[model samples]
Target: MTAAASDINFCFPVRELESERVKLTPFIPDLHADLYFQGSAAYPELYDFIPWEAFTDTSDFVKKVIEGCVRPDTGIALYAVIDKTPTGTNPSKPTSANFAGIMGYTNTSPANLSTEISYALILPPFQRTHVTTNAIGLLLQYALDSPPHGLGLRRVQWKANRLNTKSINAVQRLGFKLEAILRYDRIFVGSKTNAANGERERAGDPRPGTVGTDTALLALCWDDWESERARVLQAMDRRS
Candidate 1:
């Protein structure tokens, strides 16, 4: 395998964090099966755009996690969010790594130092919890931290289907500035990819499904990220 390249310095491998009632950790091999099932079941509609088959097997998912942790350039950094059920209470609830989601750059556009951001999968009991917010905060914080890996970061962005209001609101609530809705700018469910790079062969697939046309592109920049992280952390402090 190629030695981790330009992006190796950009990631924090195996990061761990506590968010009120949950623990966010790097994706572990054992949790792959559950994570795969949870992610696929949680968002079937997103299949057209994402490659879910790669995670069907425990080994494959484990490999993916390993790659994300050790490989640069290619693999997106992944984090699994686990609920911390308090055993100190009346009844003890099982605590385990729940689902896997990722955040990283696909490509940085030349016009500006902007990068795309994507995160998902909060299976079953984990849905609608503070974990998502906390994880997102961590992602933004990591992106804007300081020199070295963080120096080139100017914008963090999210793009989803025109009808994906839930995604739109979620990013907006986190204070991402909605930039533009480029008409027919994406190609989903087909072979033409319109990401920062024009249509090209996928990393592994020569003939991937065409994910045609999407409109909304929500974005958060270093300025907005600073304010949002402060608000989120302050709110967390108040709750504690």
Candidate 2:
């Protein structure tokens, strides 16, 4: 459908999205512990471009997930990424799924029939595996599906730090095209220690020499998805 003809009141339903390797379910307080464990384990590596550090406990993690990530009023829907493979020592026996990470959609603009996918965080074990690939494939399929099946959005965007080559490569491999770079897009303040001067500064001190991050914008519009859907789906299935 054309962007103008698409429903302006389109709302993303909170539900589960599954692929061969991963399952995405609506975020809940009950899953906070598992989310915290996985996210905290990844720690500073995952936080390099994510703009947030690992949580100290379930309470801290749940508060951020509720207040920051899954704000329904703002049209953001967060999901817990669960690993579908067997986790216990018994490979032949089924085991409870483990929380691998989190991902979701934000910056939704129904009037424009567009939304940006953001806040994807997968643990070390799942990185470079087919889990993320399949998760994104599932999301794309749902976002682009026609009425009675999905939202049929005209545009789906992906943004990342310009210096984050890993993230950029991941999305590009998924068929998103690089659009532009937003210069000095976000400011991040933190403590600095001067070895020569033996001086220490606390976070948010607002001192000089602080640098901000530039955002690299990428997108998969309806036309792009239509043209590339088959190939992308084939790649996902092949990799699965």
144-173: candidate 1 lDDT, tens digit per residue:
556553444678787765556766787787
- Global local distance difference test of model 2: 0.68
Q: Which prediction has the highest TM-score against the true structure?
A: 2
Tell me the spans in candidate 2 whose CA falls farther than 4 Å from its real position.
Answer: 1-10, 87-97, 191-210
Give the CA lDDT, 0 to 100, for residue 236 in model 2.
Answer: 71
lDDT of each: 0.53, 0.68
Residue-wise C-alpha lDDT for candidate 2, range 157-208, written one tens digit per residue:
9998887888889889878999998876765554312111222335776655
TM-score for each of the candidates: 0.62, 0.80
Model 1: CA > 4 A from native: 1-14, 30-34, 38-75, 85-114, 147-152, 190-211, 234-240
TM-score of 2: 0.80
lDDT of 2 at 116: 83
